[model samples]
Target: MNNRIKKIENNVQDKNSAAWKKLCDYIDRVAEDGSEEFSPANELGYELFSQIYTLPETISKLKKVKKVSLYGSKLKRIPPEIGQMESLENFVPYTSYSLHWFPYEITECKNLKDSTVSTRALYGNYKNRMSFPDLSQNPVRYSGETVNCSVCRKKMTYDETNQLWISLWVGTDVLPLLANICSEHCKNALPKPPENYIQKAHKGSSTLPQPPDENESFELQIKEYEREQNTINNP
Candidate 1:
């Protein structure tokens, strides 16, 4: 396997390991006081967790944490268990380059108020416009590889799922996240993307709206400025 896939597999293994459980126990104790700050990169050694692609599902154990930082971790995904962090308010995952998306379940945190992300690395980012993975078709099941529904977490075969992609502002950045759902019920449970985005789940392809070229974007900005000037003068 390539280094990228290897890192992801390693992260998955770490999530299930005893060491990860120990880490979770530490965080859980700190979370109860709601005063201590947590920076996994610093506590765990940046070089160690930086290669991790996903956080453990034990993240839900931080029920009283008010803020969490995950700066510079090379994460590819976050577990939906994060939605269970009832006291979470601030989320920082700045510079996590490989994390292209987030789980829609994050909206379950009613107290979550702010977030920071590396927008440039995101799929379909406004400035970069990187294309998202083509998710209209279900991913093929590899022999012995397990596939689970993103929402329900139930074991499923590739043929038993439907794939959808949506972009939403989970905290402060709009992230393009993918969901492999087992049924339409789970798909409907997704919250809407932030206002002024594509406004619907879509398959990744050239058909999606393209960002304007530099010249075109500049001209559009000039026209917008002129229109605003006219409105100000007349009003």
Candidate 2:
């Protein structure tokens, strides 16, 4: 079997990086002007854009954006603050292979109805059976000042919270979400995962069981992705 699924590090935005400043500036413009769409790649240019490994917590300021297009981003994770983008509707992070999971808080975007994602790269995606990060071993971190319970929004600390993975419907896709809860009652309050998923919120570990993957359906897709990565790296 392949190696145990490792936890992908959350590369926090470097405040001193040019990419951060550019992205912050773009967000400022969007917040003041209000827009139906936001695409940082086009705004930051390829040079600075490639440096973006994750978005800022300031993403919550985009209160009026109806769509977010992060096609081909290098992001490893999205901040939980994205849940505050109440007007968000279409989320397009289609080719962002490094983005393995989302914050459970994303479900709070009541208007999000459509999304484009790289299913094979996502943790717990039915197409790949990618292993989720073993939260039991890896420490949980939050983008906010304090970790809050994903269910009831109760304030919590590292010593008081339990972090787990849950595959839930976000827009039209069922994506793996990281949930930080203060108590078992909050965990029990989590919405059930859809059919074909793990069926419950679970602390991810290598020993954690999962449904068998249909390798035949995704072999070519995986190979193609590898080829593209090879070309980008070798060229």
Task: State model 1's lDDT.
Answer: 0.68
**Residue pair clashes in candidate 1:** none
Stretches of candidate 1 off by over 4 Å are 1-36, 136-159, 185-189, 210-216, 223-235
Q: Which numbered prediction scores highest in lDDT against the true structure? A: 2
Reference-based lDDT, each prediction: 0.68, 0.85
lDDT of 2: 0.85
TM accuracy, model 2: 0.87
| Clash totals for all candidate models | 0, 0
| Total residue pair clashes for candidate 2 | 0
Tens digits of per-residue lDDT for model 2, 1-235:
1224856674356779878898989988988898878899999987898888878888899999999999999888888889999999999999998888899999999999999999988777777687877887786675555788888888877778899899999999999999988988898899989887898999887667787566744676788899999999999
